[model samples]
Target: MKKSLAMLLAGAMVVASLTACGSGKKETTAETTSDTTAESAESKTVSDGETYKIGVLQLTEHAALDAANEGFVAALDDSGISYEIDQQNAQNDQSACQTIAEKLVNDGDDLILAIATPAAQAVAGVTTEIPIVGTAITDFADSGLVESNDAPGENVTGSSDLTPIKAQISLLQKVLPEAKKVGVLYCSAESNSEIQLQMTKEACTAAGLDVEEFSVASSNEIQSVVESAVGKVDCLYTFTDNTIAAGMNTVTMVANENNLPVICGEQGMVEAGGLCTYSIDYYELGYIAGEMAVKILKGEAEPATMPIEYYPEEKCEFVGNEETAKLLGIDISGLE
Candidate 1:
């Protein structure tokens, strides 16, 4: 009887100890599971948050550039992406552009948006590692921004406001059908403008019109260059070169004195004082660039792989200044 009682006590003690141990193990497992669930939720919240810093370098403070800058910011705001835009205008100074580019690079920007050819070139010189999205670039390859427009295959990519060069020539020819000699005006330092001058020269030559090239180093040279060419060529034409466009009143004054008609590369150019133009929408160009930037910042697209985009002919419009038309005494009745 004593042994039986002792065995019963031992068995009961073993069962009680096992139950306590099992309960302890169950409690530990529940606590571990609860911790893992909480940790997972915390990690998910951390992963869901994102922030970006964007740097913008604009070449000048002209109407076209200002519009582009506005469009870019508006698009970024509309994307619902958390970001900060650090913007600086170069004021049409090459050295200023370089300084701005260096500052943006040093700030460790997530990306850079260049608003013109000079700004893009400046940013491209700063870093190959930082992606650059450029708008209002006339020629990607000509500007030395990329190896190819398709599959840029490099660190630079964006939209081009390359207005229809040939169409511009056509518009000029329509307005001055009998004009034999056409004078081209632009800034010599602007590679974009140089490209336009060359293309325009070629187009005019092909059209059997004599081409007179007049180049200026800056706005200060505009008066002399225009004065010399205004009376010489039957008509005057210029691209949306920031330098020349900025001093347009001086140019129109000279051209007007000679009763010369002016054809321009953009609406802003015409708004200043030109007969007409086949041009791209500067705001839309910048807006498209902004959208591309969002993709790049989100890691959805790489600048190297992103194809350089261009506006279609439909996006191109014929804009003219009627006030200037009346002043020049040019019959634009057919164009309206």
Candidate 2:
């Protein structure tokens, strides 16, 4: 009977040991689940708390560029995403753009916004991983920024402000219907201006008009170049060349003296002195760029995959500087 009692006691102890082992296994499983839950919550918070930073490189502080910057910032705000914008104006200097790009890359911005062709090229040369959005650029293909206008197919994409070549020619023909020979003046070093010259030459040929090109490397050459162009051509076409646009007073004086009606690529140039122009809304282009930045931040889009966007329709307006118009003797209302 004592030996039976001892065996029973030993069996009871074994049963208790098994129950304790089972309880420990259940607790271990519960603890593991709790740990995984905590880790997931932390990851989620991290993602939610991240604030994006954007670097902006503007080639100059001209009206068009300023409008673009304003539009871009507004669009970013509209996205409901928190971001810090680091904006720098390059003052129309290519070296300044390069320096600004290097600084942005060194600062490790989430993305870069290039406001013009020069600024875009500068940033693109800096880094590939940091996404880039460009605005106010004309002819992504001619700028060498991408392979095609439809699909940039690289780490850079943005909106272009290229007015339709045919439309521009039509506007010119409407304003100066009797004029035969047209002279195109631009900065030789500006690739954007070169693209415009090429397009203008083609469109003028189609319009049964003769087009001649005159190039100025800097501000000092404007007088001599303008005098030569005015002496030869009946009308003058000025592209959105920064150098010439910045020295517009001189261009207007020379052009008006020669009675050469000028048509410009951008509104700012038109306002300064040109007779009339059809241009893209640069501010809207910038706003589109801001929208692109949000997609990059949310990981919803990739720069290499983002196709370059263009304005739905070009915006046309007549500056009608009465004084300048009278000097050119262009019957503004008659043209309409």
lDDT tens per residue, model 1, 1-336: 999999999999999999998876321111111321111111101223466777888887777777887787777777777775666777778888888888879978888999889999999998999889999888888889999888787889999887787888888888888899988888999998888888887888888888888899988999899889856889888887989887888888888878889898888878877788888888888888999999998899999999899988776877888898898888777674
TM-score for all models, in order of appearance: 0.83, 0.81
> Considering every candidate listed, which one attains the maximal TM-score?
1
Best by lDDT: 1
Q: What's the lDDT of the predicted structure labeled candidate 1?
A: 0.82
lDDT of 2 by residue, 166-270 (tens): 776788888888889988888998888888788888899999999888889987999899988866888888766777877777888888888888887777777
Question: What C-alpha lDDT values do all the predictions have?
Answer: 0.82, 0.78
RMSD of 1: 12.0
Q: Report clash pairs, candidate 1.
A: none
Which stretches of model 1 miss by more than 4 angstroms? 1-48
